[model samples]
Target chain A: MSRITECFNNLKSQGRKALIPYVTAGDPDPKITLPLMHALVESGADIIELGIPFSDPMADGPVIQLACERALLHGTRLVDVLDMVAEFRKTNQTTPVVLMGYLNPIEIMGYSAFADKAKAVGLDGVLTVDLPPEEAGEFNRLMKASDIDVIYLLAPTTEEARVQKICAAGSGYVYYVSVKGVTGSASLNVAEVAEKLKMIRKYTEMPVGVGFGIRDDASARAVSEVADGVIVGSVLVNKIAELTGNQEQIPEAVAAITASMRQAMDK
Target chain B: MPTKEDLAIAKQMPDAGGHFGQFGGRYVSETLMAALQQLEQTYEKLWRDPQFQAEFDYDLAHYVGRPSPLYHAERLSRELGGAQIYLKREDLNHTGAHKVNNTIGQALLAKFTGKPRVSAETGAGQHGVATATVAARLGLECTVYMGEDDIRRQALNVYRMKLLGAEVVSVTSGTRTLKDAMNEAMRDWVTNVDNTFYIIGTAAGPHPYPKLVRDFQSIIGREARQQCLAQTGKLPDALVACVGGGSNAIGLFHPFIEDADVRMIGVEAGGYGIETGQHAAPLSSHCKPGVLHGNRTCLMSDEGGQVIGTHSVSAGLDYPGVGPEHSYLQEIGRAEYTAINDDEALHAFRHLTLTEGIMPALESSHAVAEAMKMAPTMDKDQIILVNLSGRGDKDIHTVAGIDGINF
Candidate 1:
């Protein structure tokens, strides 16, 4: 079983919900990112998702977009993200780190090279926002060969036929988008997401992580009730944006949100 | 020298690795790496599929009004000496440009793949309009990304697209033009890969798109060949076409690339001059071989790979890159490329409007300028065919202001 699957199984065995904290790698600074990754794990983050900053991030909400813009302005590329992960692996290797972002940067670096590099750098999985299940052959092959999981996204608009294809292509876990529009849009229907999750369960045995608008503890707790994992992106990116260039506030902000999410999911 | 029979033989053979000589290949993102390969393999399989060919050919002929008129420019020819100029009138196409020929075919392929929506980027708004028109016809939702500047300059087209039921998105990032619009469209394709089909406008982009779009647009040359022979009893001495992303040029040139006696000329937009640092002449300026928006082709950039700004009276030809096929033709010495300055294009734009009573698009006027140059040097009996890529109706206001003409 994959680390992500194993972690979720452990959570399920303990009757606990998973807390997945997302952070844009190299946001603010790379120096602080490694430590922040450790802090998230210490503060009760069940899984860590490191967003690889891309020049054009269309799937991102405004908060994460700003964080990406800030990271890109400071010269963050896929190589930089991989380097950070490699460094983090030296001290901490058990926590699963999934790289989430657009495909261009990875395209700039060839797929085989990227897959190999990702594995060498201790990446557990990859969730390319743009590559759908039908188009994930070579990427999935390379990831599987390198012992890395290839995650797929299940959207509200996804059809039943497509769910089978996505499940067949997917590994680690399926990311279930809670809304129809870009990130940060406030039109998520939790009941609709729960219904989609129930539908998804019929298609795949993989864990389902619901994200896109899980902004606070209440929302996270609400999603965690049905989902195997509650994935929070915009909220964490917002905290990073606020703490940028101010190192002292990074840990405090990240810890408070992580603790709150942990408590909310546990209850 | 290949005879018409020999040319037909060459066309029968699929390009090696789906390239027209050295022009096309899969130069794209790792995320799309698998998708493009799958598409390429599928295209190869379906290229001979009777069902796919029948559907594509039927749409081209019945829907797009294929075999666009081969009109003799008698008046314009009389004024430019006795040299007869014939226009393969692609402007008469359904969406008022040759772009529709490709979009319709690609949209069909998108349907075949079961994609839900079609997405594209536009500059002159011709391609966007074409994609929008086809998407509506095929019952697919269309989203067109355009540069904010182009949205303002080509307002009429913007309205036309909206009227056609496409969601017209004005891209506000990057250089705010065609190239930037292309970047945004690629981003959207990456994000919505599950349900979206990226209908690229030109014979550019990465591997399969340039080759696929060129083949779709090749109906122009295929029909023009039969019509030219039927009308004039022979092929012309020269083929001239404008090269923005070089779709129209390649469409016209591909059918005649091996016809050793037929000369091919591609006109680039020379905003000022090649040395003025303000032109879109990618072949003549500081362009090197690099990959952008999926294709390996000539790109105008500085030492640091930052795309430089380009200037042109025509928004469509203002792109900083040329089609990969054009780059290949240049390297192999099969075609000659020249530049038409803004002043010369403006002059030709008015001249065609006044002399021929056919208002050509400013992008097409670049070919008009080159035809004018070639006319004077050729013998009176020598014939030339110009791919009238699009109608000038979209460029009237810009031309009027540039020429200082009241009407």
Candidate 2:
């Protein structure tokens, strides 16, 4: 089975939701990302969403965007991100790592080559922010061939027909953007997310991961009640941003926040 | 790899999936895909619907001013002692530019789709001013996103948009230029999909946009085609237009795609020069296809795939990416794209002011410069028709500042 599928199944038997913490692969520096991934797994993260630093992150708000800028400053390329994932895989084989990014970098590297290298590097899946299913035919084919889950996002504005189409096209899980705005912009309205989740569930049996506004444990717990998984990004990325200047404080700072959300979800 | 069959259909482009010969596709987040699909559907319908066509025609004729004159530049032609040159006066349109043509069409779409608030991203604020003008006319609320740097450079147009009651938000993202403003606007559209309509200034972005903007702006070529036939008794031997995001150039070229007898050329902003590596001529110099914004197209980027900053005296043509259709056109050799340096463009800007008493927008001056160069090499009986896409009034400040003048 795919790592994303197996991870969700393991969490399902535990009567708990998946805690997926996102950190850019080379945020503060390349040397630090390996320790950060291990720390996330220690903090009860079921999966790690590694951001491949892109120049223009359109779906992201300022925090994650700045995180990308920081990573790019150190000359983090796609190969560098793949190497980080490979290094993290040595110690922690159970935790799935999903590379999250825009399409251009992968397009630059060629999609087939990216998929092959990602699978070889122990990356479980990918979530390209800008590539919807309509543009994902070749990308989906190549990733599927490589046994990697090709994830897609559904938004609050997504219609029923498109949700059905996206769910059918995607694998492992469908990320539900809980708010109308970009990442890190606002807080989630749990009731509205619950309502949207009910409609989304009608489309597919794949686990639905709610993100885009799940900042703290309270919001994570609230969304975990209705969602199959709770993905926390910008808020944790904001922590990384706060510690970007300091070299040593990043992993602990990021893990401490992830642990809090983990504790909240477990409780 | 693009198939030979795919290249054959640049004329009947976008194929249902929005691929212009493997270049254009709706490469946006899922949040915007539904909107793009809806837009494509709406456009496919309204573009054929007689009632919608009548409404658009009415607005063009009465509100925005249609059939802008195609005047023969007699004095400029004689001075060069070469091909006769004609100018399609898109400058005479409402809002003092060709931008209003697309804005009026998109504003009507917004009205049809029941979107009460419209948003746009601008470089020089001409598109912002044009969009604000349309929103005011249609009683819709409008907001414009512009880069902080551009908001300062194009300060007069900033004031003009505000005077039109647009809320101009200054974007401070990545390099703070037109590309950044577009990224911010796309984010806003993804967030506010229900009520807000994004009126993209250029014919770039994802699907249906290049096609939609071209369909609307093709009035320039359609009129020029008939006007040329009526005046000179044959289609012009060549067509020239400046390309930033290629809306004006495409609008002027789409109707003539089948006219093998008529040659087409697109001029890109060369900034300093192509050799200096400070220009915006993606197709002419640094032509490599990559995805930026929402479509696969020729882009200006570093080796790491990060879009780099571009420079041009004309703010509108200073973007790093061109329309995807332009990429397809370049690949298929249906049209030729070249570059004009900042000095060459500025020289044409002055030369036109002296010879024709018409001040060309710096964005349009690229076309003027190229046309002058090509005109001198062709027979005097041959003709070149240039899409004078806008007036130069908004650019006077930048030109004067360069010339060490206060105003």
Per-model interface RMSD values are 6.7, 1.1
The positional error of residue B90 in candidate 1, measured at the CA in angstroms, is 3.0
* Candidate 1 chain B worst ten-residue window by lDDT: B22-31
Q: Write the per-residue lDDT of candidate 2 for residues B1-407, one digit (tens) a residue.
A: 33445434666887788788879888888788778888989999888999999999999999988989999999999989999999999999989889999999999899999999999999978899999999988889999999999998899999999898899999998889899999999989988888999999989998888889888998999999999999999999999999999999999998888776688899999999999889999999956788888999999877667787899989899899999888888888878999999999999999999999999999999999999999889999999999999999998988899889995
Tens digits of per-residue lDDT for model 1, B276-349: 98899998663776556665567775542335678887899989888888887776667789999988998888
Candidate 1 residue pairs in clash (backbone atoms < 3 Å): A107-B29, A107-B30, A130-B190, B25-B207, B206-B294
Which window of 10 residues has the lowest lDDT sum in candidate 2 chain A? A238-247
Q: What is model 1's DockQ versus the real complex?
A: 0.08
DockQ of each: 0.08, 0.77
Residue B382 of model 1 has an lDDT of: 84
Classified by CAPRI criteria, candidate 1 counts as: incorrect
Candidate 1 positional error at A5, Å: 4.9
Each candidate's lDDT (Cα)? 0.81, 0.90
Pairs with steric clashes in candidate 2: none
